[model samples]
Target: MEENTFKKGLIDGLPIGIGYFSVAFAFGIFALRCGLKGWQAVAISATNLTSAGQIAAVPIIAVQGSLVELASTQLVINMRYFLMSVVLSQKLKPETTVLDKLIIAWCNTDEIFAVCTGKDYRLDKRYCFGILIPPYLGWTLGTLAGVLAGDVLPAIITDSLSIAIYGMLIAVFVPAGENDRNMLMCIAISVALSLCFFYLPYLRELPGGFTIIICAVAASVFMAVKAPVGGDG
Candidate 1:
């Protein structure tokens, strides 16, 4: 049963791995253009799984932002994962050890969490490892490839690709926002706040990391209070 479950996880994870490859490729180039070396870009992908957080960190690194700014930015952007980890933990067997849980937590990415939640049964270590392995390698290798090829690609082409790279963010929010009014409002609020931070006097001087933290936290807190999740109709 464990073997079968492991294979099932590998099969299910293949698509996610492929998706990460393409997205990580874009990020690789983006990081390269941001002045990160090839190894540094690959190292970031190897160590981190959250694409949005990684992308958000680029400007912070570029400006040599303070550790406080970077740490706060990461906490705000990746805070959802803390909640996600708590939820996903319920799927583990009671006998699951702390070490195993730590390993699984390291791999508890958004897509992996979704896949686990879609399953009715408990997730064992084997299945979690199986599911995580390919995507992890794909992400790291994709970044490496991107960095190595950055110098080979034409300047105009790489520049143009940067704009299209963020299409992933659009893909995620557009469909969800179309169907959910609350989510749409949240998206709008974040965007408006972001614009304010960009254009408003004094606010415009704020570090990029803090700007994201403020925008995201403000919109989230307002929405959480106004329309709590899972409230009865």
Candidate 2:
């Protein structure tokens, strides 16, 4: 029996959804640390699924950072989404319309992109929409859980939860680096530059948001020019 494509999307998204819960749970705790109330933390997760952007934004908000800092930081961090959306557009069925594309763009995430692109055939709007449901629910619920837990858990326990987000970041880094030597160099350069921002005099004084923007752009551009993935393929 042929399974429905929508059903296939939901099933495929399940693992990604589960993984997101664990990561989002940690993010919930981190949001609390940044002085966001429980509802605000949950709202952020519900509305925006980009964990890195959330992490970057929450701290800035906590410190009452400038609007320029918030806007520039989020733009730099999330600029990749435009690229990702463009790439995913290529995978849609020929009959897909502008409104359908707009909906897909709203729901797209890194995990969803990986799932949709891993297959060979063109995807319809049904499958694309179906796949996003589980992840969206999991992320929102996880944040809610984290917020509730943060309110009650001892500081010692909540502090221990800090490691989970770092783990999530490493999980993102390792796979790309392992597959491509060039990408590994990019990751290494980004890490080294970030450490300098953390420790070096004068450089350490730069605003956190700009420091991230500079390091990320510098490493990505240096590597892309040096290696030029698939040589313009």
Candidate 3:
């Protein structure tokens, strides 16, 4: 039964694996361009399956941002993972051990969370491992390929490929926004705020990391206050 569940998870995670490959490939190239070695790029993807956060981190690293800047940037950008993990904990099998939770937490990407939590039944450890492993492999392999190819590829091609990351972000948010007015509003507000920070002289002078934190926290607060979901205070 556990074997069958593991197989089912692999089959369900196929598309996510494919998507991860392309995104991680871009990350590989980007990381190299940002001055990381090929091995470092691969190591990053293997350890941290976060596409957006990793991409955002590259510039900070290139600028030699302080530890506080790095930590705060990651915290604000990846804060959603905290909520995702909490939701996933509820869907885990009651018998899941601390070790299992730790492993699952380490490998919990957004795609993994989506696949694991979308199931109606409590997730078994084997099933979670099956879903987690393939994408993890894909991401690492893709990053390796990208880092190797980054130097050989023409500047034009490598530069153009950078846009793929933004495309991935749009792919995630656009469909959900179409269905949820509140989410749509939140996205719009966030984008507007981000643009303001970019264009306004004073705000533009603020550290990029802090700007992101302010924009994200402000948008979340505005949404919570203006469009609180069914729950009470």
lDDT (0-100) at residue 9 of candidate 3?
73
Instruction: Give candidate 3 regions above 4 Å deviation.
Output: 1-4, 33-35, 52-80, 90-95, 111-127, 205-213, 231-233
Runs in model 2 with CA error above 4 Å? Answer: 1-4, 151-233
Each prediction's RMSD to truth = 4.9, 4.3, 4.3
Candidate 3 shows a clash count of: 0
Candidate 2 local lDDT, 1-233, one digit each (tens): 33338888899778777777767888898888889888999998988898888888999888889999888888877776776687788888889998988777877887788667655677888888889988898889989988888757676765565566456446666887897898899989998999999999999987665677678779989987998867322
Query: Which regions of candidate 1 deviate over 4 angstroms?
Result: 1-4, 154-233
**Candidate 3 whole-model C-alpha lDDT, 0 to 1:** 0.79
Poorest 10 consecutive residues of model 3 by lDDT? 160-169
Could you tell me the C-alpha RMSD of candidate 2 in Å?
4.3
Candidate 3 residue lDDT tens string, 126-156 = 7887788788888889898888777677777
Q: What is the lDDT of candidate 2?
A: 0.80
Best by the TM-score measure:
3
Candidate 1: the clashing residue pairs are none
TM-score of 2: 0.70
- TM-score leaderboard ranking: 3, 2, 1
Best by lDDT: 2
77 in model 2: Cα distance from truth in Å?
Answer: 0.8
Ranked by TM-score, the better of candidates 2 and 3 is 3
